[model samples]
Target: MLKAQETVLEIDLKALKHNFDHLKSRISSNTKFMAVVKAFAYGSDACEIANYLQKLPVDYFAVAFVHEGIQLREAGITKPILVLHPQAVNFNILIENCLEPSIYNVKILNEFIATASAEKLNDYPIHIKFNTGLNRLGFSENDVDTIISTVNESTSVKIESVFSHLAASEDLNEKDFTLNQIKKFKNITENMTKQMGYKPLLHMCNTSGILNYPEAHFDMVRSGIGLYGFGNSEKENKNFKPIGTLKTIISQIHAIEKGESVGYNRAYKTDTFLRTATLPIGHADGIGRQYGKGKGYVIINNQKAYILGNVCMDMIMVDVTNIDCKEGDEVIVFGPETTAENLAKTANTISYELITAISQRVKRLFIGN
Candidate 1:
C-alpha cells in the first residue's frame, strides 16, 4: 500500500462525498447531476474520485477527452459517461467504450455519423453543444440546420442532450449576460427540438451556474469545482467541504543573516535574520513560479509563511521566521488554513488554474470515507 506520508496531494474522499452531497441538496429532484472528472479530477485523482462518486449514484460522469472516459471505464465505472470535448479521430473508440460525445459543429457531427454508421452502431447517444455565448466550442445558431440534417440522415446516432458553456456564471456582475445566454440556449434548444421532434436532456450550467441560477438548471447540472469543494464564489463554497488538501514535508531548513538573499536572482532578501524552510515541491509539481517572490504563501504549523524567491522546478523556499519548525515538519501549501483561492489571487490567477495545473508527477494519496 502507498503511504500518505509520501505525497503532496492528500485526497479526502470524505470531503469529496460531503461536497457532492452538498451540491446534490441544492439540485432539483428533476435535475440530473453530472460530475466532471476531467484533468485528473482537477489534478487530484480521477480514477479514485470517479470510483467514489459512482458509489454515490451520480446521474452522469463527464471528462474532457475520450481517453479520460476510457480511463474511468477501465477503472470499472459503469455509469453513463460523456466526453465533453472529444475529437473526431476518437469517435470510433468513444463508441466502442460506450462513451457519449458532445457534437459541437458540422464537421464533428458528420465525422461521428460516418464513424457510427461504419461501426454499425444504432442509436448511440450523443450531445449537441450550442455556442450560446462562450464562443469557445459549440455550434452557432446558424449551424443548427446542418446539424439537424446530419442527425436526421443518420440512423446510427441519437441526440442525448443539448448543452452549452456559461462564460461567467460566477460573477454576479454578469447576471444579465448569463441570463441572456440562458435565454439564447433555451431558444436554440426549442428550435432544434421542434425541428427534430424530440428533446434530449438539456444542460448549460457548470458548478457556478447550478448554484447561482436554478431557473436555468434545464435537465442536468455539470459540476467540476463544486465537487472539489471550492465554488466560484465564497458564498457558494460555504456549503461544501473541500476535497483536496495539498501538504508536503519540509525537507530542510536554513538560518539566514540579515540582508541575506534567497533563491534565483536574489528574488527575496531577508530584512532581518530569519529562518527559512524548503519543501520538495516546485513549479514542475504545479506549485508554479508565480507563487514566489513574496507573492504567495503557505501555512506552517498553522502560521503563514510567505514564499521567498523564484520557485524552482522541484522546490520552493518559505520564510518560516518566528515559527517553531524543523526538518520534516508538515507544510500546508494550500488547504484549510490558506486556500488555493488565496494563493491564486496572490499569483494573479484563479483556483481553477491552481488546482488543474497540478502536475501528474505529484503523488496522490486517497483517504476513503
Candidate 2:
C-alpha cells in the first residue's frame, strides 16, 4: 500500500503485471494479444501503461483514434498500433505515422484506399471491422463482398485483420446474443478469407469476452479493462487486481453544532453535534456531485465517513466525528479494501465510468515499477 499527500491516483505496476499475466494465462500462447490503450489507457496515463505492456510485448496495440496512436508514437512506443476508429481527415497522417486504421464502412474503406494510394504504400496494413450486433461501428455483414472487391481493385491497401466487437459478453443472460454475434463474425471472416484467398489475423474479444467467451478468441484478442484489473464479473474480478487506488488527505476538521448546515446550498443539516473533515477532492476531480449527501463515503482510520453534503468542484466534507482522526490523516477514497466497483454502486453506475472519470489534474503515483 502507498500513502497520498494530496489527491492522487496511484498506479501500481506490480498489480498491472499481475493482471496481464492472469489474462495471458487464459489464452493460448499461439494466439496474439492486442492491448487497447485508448482514452489515456482508460484514464490512467496511456504512455505509461503502453510502455509497460510493450515490455510484456503484446503483439499489437489499439486506440480509439489516430491522435492517441500519435501520442504513443511521440512517447517512444515502437510497436504496431491499430487506430480503432479513424477519421478520413487523419488518414494521410495515420499512414504517415505507420498506424493502422479500422475500416468499418464503405466511405472509410474507400477514403483510406485513396490515402494509401496517394502515399504509394504497398500492402499497407488496414483492419476491417464488421457489424455483428454491437451496431455502434463496423461494416454490415453483407459488406464482405463489397469490402473484398474494393480491396482487390487496389494494391495500395491490404487487409491486415478482420474483427468485430461483442455487445455483452459478461452477462450470461446475453449468451444467446453474443453467440449469434460470434456466428456472424465467423461467417463474415470465412467469406472474407475465401474471396481474398488469404487469411488475415482475426480478433474480436474484449476484456470480458476474453474471460467468459474463450471460444470466440480468434487469432488475436484485445484486452482493455482486464489489463487494468476488472473482469466485469464478480467471480472473475477476484482473479484480477485493480491497479489504480484513489487517495487523499484531510485538510481541516470542524466541530459543528446540531442543525448546522454544510457545503453548497446547505444541502446537509446536522442532526446532532458532530465533527466533519474536509478533503481536497470533489466533482471536478471525478467524484461528481451525485456522490454528495451521504451517497459516497471515504475511509478514515478504517471507518466509513459518509459525505455530508454537496460536493464542491475541488473539495468535499465527510462526517468523521466518530473516527479518532485529525487533519492531514490519510484517507482512502477508493482502493483495494474499498473497491471502486463498490463505491460506484452508490451512484447507480459501474466501475468503468468511475475509474475513467478520474481527472488528470489529480497527481498520479506509480508503485512497484
Candidate 2 Cα errors over 4 Å, as ranges: none
Q: Pick the candidate with the highest TM-score.
A: 2
TM-score of each: 0.96, 0.98
Sliding window of 10 residues with minimal summed lDDT for model 1: 1-10
Q: Per-residue CA lDDT of candidate 2, range 133-236, in tens?
A: 98899999888888888999999988999999999999899999999999999998998899999899999999999998889999999999998888998899
In lDDT terms, how accurate is model 1?
0.88
> Local distance difference test, per candidate?
0.88, 0.92
Model 1 TM-score is 0.96
C-alpha positional error of residue 279 in candidate 2 after TM-score superposition, expressed in Å: 0.6
